[model samples]
Target: MHRQIAGKLTGPVTKWIVLVGAIVLVGIMAPLNGKLIDVQNNEASSWLPQSAESTKVVEQLTGTVDPNDIPTLLVYHRDSGLTTADLAAMDEDAKEIEQIKGVTAQGAFSPNEAKALIASGAKVPPLLSDDDKVAFVAFTFNFGKNGWQDIPDAADKVRELSKIDGVDVHLAGFGGQASDASEAFEGIDTNLIFITLLVVIVILLFTYRSPVLWVLPIISAGFSYMISGGVVYLLAKYADLTVNGQSQSILGILVIGAGTDYALLLIARYREELRRHEDRHEAMAFALHRAAPAILASAATVVIGMLCLVFADLNSTAGLGPVLAVGVGVTFLIMVT
Candidate 1:
């Protein structure tokens, strides 16, 4: 059955060229989608540098969290040799803070850091609670009172001090904290996309028992996401928009479920028509005629539901809404072919 279809489709060169072209397109568009935009290690790995725009974006998302202050907490448990003498070790940092301009305050908090994090309401603590194992310190960097980048070199200085010996320390806050979060979430997005594709492949393999059947939906959905992602990147770069942490997961759900669903609906009808009509072309025509309406309706409903996100005030939700909508729309369009 597979060979019959392949023989009828014409030259292998045309198929090969089209297949290679698609892969090239996917590679190009993956970064534009804003999910795969990592330039790790080398000089370029520092793609999105800390700047006024980044500071402002963080500020917008975290209301009342001052970006210029660039605060990081040093938490040590009471059991981690954090006695009065160890607490005095923080005074060593006072010299580092004084030497570094825009460095506002550096002080040690005993086990009381937990209480401060829970009560002070300045910023939420990133680490977990372990009162016996942790002593905390808040290092406030005054970026010249201008903004995060203006404190001259506060984050760099914080990184420098984090290297102090004896006690274990982590330099965290708006700047370093955001970077850590981004790094942790990076693998999850790609895994989500792959998992979506994996589920689709499993469905196809079980239903068709043919490799060719799996290829169709994979090519269709992958290309649609690639194109949509490229457009997303352009929007992010030029329009100053953002694709938040879960944006790719949203795209994965839409692309995988809808793409496989469209393919499933079409294939089911095609099989039904094949049993009644002897000709493959006639069966295809029948299937297309019957399945197209349902596909369109499903796509329409998805678009309508997602567009509602435009009314949301949170930029992250609003950002994900359109990217996912575009991805669904792209899947619908690709299914047309």
Candidate 2:
């Protein structure tokens, strides 16, 4: 059965048809691959089970408290005591921050307001430290569903507006952390792809010992990555599949690793067959016929293992399984073809 299938695929007319078809399919999938990042659900609740207490509380407070609200603290410190000028600058900074599109004005206390509240016995926490060398502004920002994406810019704007001579300003609290995280993940996809490709190329070069021979596997891996990313994008967008930064990054690594593994198996078998058969096409057909079973078995094992993650209670873990399974499955199809 494998031999017949291999013969049909490697036949004189069918070979060109398969090549053209694969190329056309890759071209169609390219754009979808580029859009995979847009649908990623990175919110904290996304990782939690719907029945979890935290998730339930978040759902209960959805309307009363904005789910998108990110509490932020702008802390300022000076080795010396803060001057009247510093307090005035901080007040001005608070006013400007409230003007920022996503920043909420409610409950955002400026230095003057905090001092007034303290004097009026309103039970507000003192914004200034007892030593009078430190102070902070407390506020919240709502940037809708994907607030994490906008946090870095908002934090930057606050820093720009809050500049005071001899005082060091720092962003703290959830907004600050989210801003840092967003920045960290900003170029993750590009960096991971580049590093993965470079590592694979070097390993393939060392293993194959031929400058030109390594390119085929790399090309095959690249096609597999593109196809997998496109398919994952569609699943996330339409099928409600969860694809976070971690899973997206892992997808590339799995595709490259699996694709290269399958390529090596086929290449080794093809090389052995070449020594026995005079015709290159006949050797390739024999190679595919023999290697197909092992390659299929390996891919199936990985796919089943990944699918088992679907049983996990954590949404992130459950989603990771299918995402990786899709990658390995796509890689196998591309390499086999």
TM-score for each predicted model, relative to the true structure = 0.61, 0.92
True-vs-predicted CA distance for residue 261, candidate 2, Å: 0.4
- Model 1 Cα lDDT, one tens digit per residue, 1-337: 2334433332344445646766777788876664434211111111233344764566475577643455656544444545556555555654555566665655433334435566777575533344445555565655532342243245556556745455567655554564355455546767887887887888899988997888988878878877777876676667755564466567766787888888888888889989998877667666767777888899989988887976665556666677788888878876644
What are the clashing pairs of model 1?
39-45, 74-137, 75-135, 76-134, 76-135, 77-133, 77-134, 77-135, 143-151
User: Which stretches of candidate 2 lie above 4 Å from their native place?
Assistant: 49-51, 105-108, 116-126
Q: lDDT tens digits, residues 4-28, model 2?
A: 8998888888988988988888898
- Candidate 2: the clashing residue pairs are none
- TM-score of model 1 (CA atoms): 0.61
Candidate 2 versus the native: TM-score?
A: 0.92
What does the lDDT read for residue 51 in candidate 2? 72
Distance from true position, residue 256, model 2, in Å?
A: 0.5
Off by over 4 Å in 1: 1-28, 34-69, 76-180, 276-282
How many collisions between residues are there in candidate 2?
0
